[model samples]
Target: MQFIDLKTQYARIEPELKVRIQAVLEHGQFILGPEVQELEARLAEFVGVRHCIGMSSGTDALLAAMMALEIGRGDEVITTPFTFIATAETIALLGARPVFVDIDPVTYNLDPAKIEAAITGRTRAILPVSLYGQCADMDAINAIAARHRLPVIEDAAQSFGASYRGRRSCALSRIGCTSFFPAKPLGAYGDAGACFTDDDALAQALREIRNHGQDRRYHHLRLGLNARLDTLQAAILLAKMEIFPEEVESRARIGARYTELFQARGALGTDVGGAPVLTPYVHPHNLSVYAQYTLQVEDREAVAAKLGEQGIPTAVHYPIPVSEQPVFHGGLLGADYPVSAAVARRVLSLPMHPYLDEATQERIVAAVAKAAGL
Candidate 1:
């Protein structure tokens, strides 16, 4: 019944987490501790990247990557609007324009066909978000970037463990960033994030940027922010990493089961398959970590209310497109971003986690079916 069973996950890793934390306490290197480097190393290896620079949060990771890339005023970063605000906020923060692109209705990711048209002479990078744990069309995006000689920054906040065409999410672009927010698929106990890249110079620049642009002790190389990941969070992430692979596999299994159940009901035109509900889509060359088991449902507010009445928790990943947000109002208007607008009105997320039990899942499905009046 819980939306994301963190308690069960905590129970599973309690002993290891305790031990990891105790080690951090004993070491007493609270900031930029050995544990942080250890975590970065493990994460980099996992992602098949040459370097991973840990930071305070995913937003900071994005900002740091932009800073390292020298993205500045008048520079434009093309991205989809059907995602969390952080994806666009970071670009705006650097005084760069976030060129909004429509999404693929089925995948809820940036539509590559729509990307080239958004590109202008000011375009410096392609910032594609891997929404809800599935990667966008990286190959297509990369092809466009290559043609323009632009860097690609993969906003992998919700897709830490996802794979695209045999490559990991965070290792697919010039620089990739992911969050360790507790709600993310692969998360630490608190705010933490990492930037991944194979380019040594960019990696070096990111390390300096995360540490206030210091090339050496007190020698400021460039303007930067104090974005270092804390020792405690690093320890927690290390503990979580021990079992993350298994958890990802478990999540895939759960997703497959949900797909089977929903597709069966959908084919039968049952309540769950009624006009209100549309299942998520997974690409053939990619694997989703199922960070959010989302559905496209009609009258989302009413469906959510009905599910709430049944004691089944449901939430929206995003209710408004980032382009329409108050902060970015009118910035992307007249862009004809039809798919992003449509997705914002309909997306609903159900309880999803590796620890989700079968009985609880069935109850959730039943409640949804009844709510949809299938």
Candidate 2:
């Protein structure tokens, strides 16, 4: 079975996708086209935000948000080390330091309690990643940011359709960024992402930042990068967005089924143990899109190898903590973020998508159970 079943999704939306792309081609307004604006508006409305600035990629979206907040040159952005490198890379790219925080062992998201301890004089923003399509504790994180008067940027790359409490993931923070990478919950055909915020000034700043800091044509207001989203990608995303809510619901159903199946077998117990495979922990106030149906498995390498032998694809979302990566080696290794380190070793992502079939899922579960020697 395909890991994400993008082919099936494309088949389902083929007619609409073709129509959208045809319109973009017919218009011949590729750069900052009408479709781009339409997508931004629709996305903003979906996320309950006042503005959405589409960008070249998720990385650029994060960079644009940071630039808007003036988070650079000795500034520190607090985040978890369990996420993809882009979370910390964007901060370091701006000459700012990424203060690593340990994750909540269960959620694999930045621990809210540990965030305050990481803040220092240079702390400019708290960038919490909504890892594995589940939002981090935004309420607590926002409260801490409020106390410190710092901006919070939600790295909602994996959590576009996810919800925290009654609010959407991208609308929960000062500025939220999400990827349209093909693997994300809500994906475009190619590289694209958007930044969302209610603050008008920050919204304008982000727009300028995405267009080389230009307030208008030939008017350079600040140094920035060319991070405009392509018209084709925008059109494709607009089509995808039409069915995104349904897909999210489908994913949650699949996730719940997987939880039930695994929980039936003691092999998927929550606590760490000899035959335990821990299902992802979703916070009570949060709804996960299950971008990846990850589980904490002991002897992860062995389990993966065995699954591979059985023609069942399994992957580790992260094998090494970001703090231990070679890029950050010899620089920011002072703290012992035990939870991040521990989760990095055990976390394994199973094939998950809205279109994942029941037969395929059953086969996968059987393979994993056999691999765990259950």
Clashes of each: 1, 0
Query: For candidate 1, what is the TM-score?
Result: 0.96
Give a tens-digit lDDT track for model 2, residues 1-374: 67888998999889999999999999899999999999999999999999999999999999999999998889889998988999999999999999998987778888898999888999999999999999999999999999999999999999999999979989999999999999899888789999999999999999999999999999999999999999999999988988999998999899988887887776555553323338876767789999899987779999999989877888888988888888997876558888788778888899999988788888898888888776
CA lDDT of 200 in candidate 1?
A: 98
Off by over 4 Å in 2: 270-277
Native-referenced Cα lDDT, model 1: 0.89
Q: Give the CA lDDT, 0 to 100, for residue 290 in model 2.
A: 92
The residue-level lDDT of candidate 2 at 212 comes to 91
Q: How high a TM-score does candidate 2 get?
A: 0.97
lDDT of 1 by residue, 68-147 (tens): 99999889999988889999999999999999988877788888998898889999999999999999999999999999
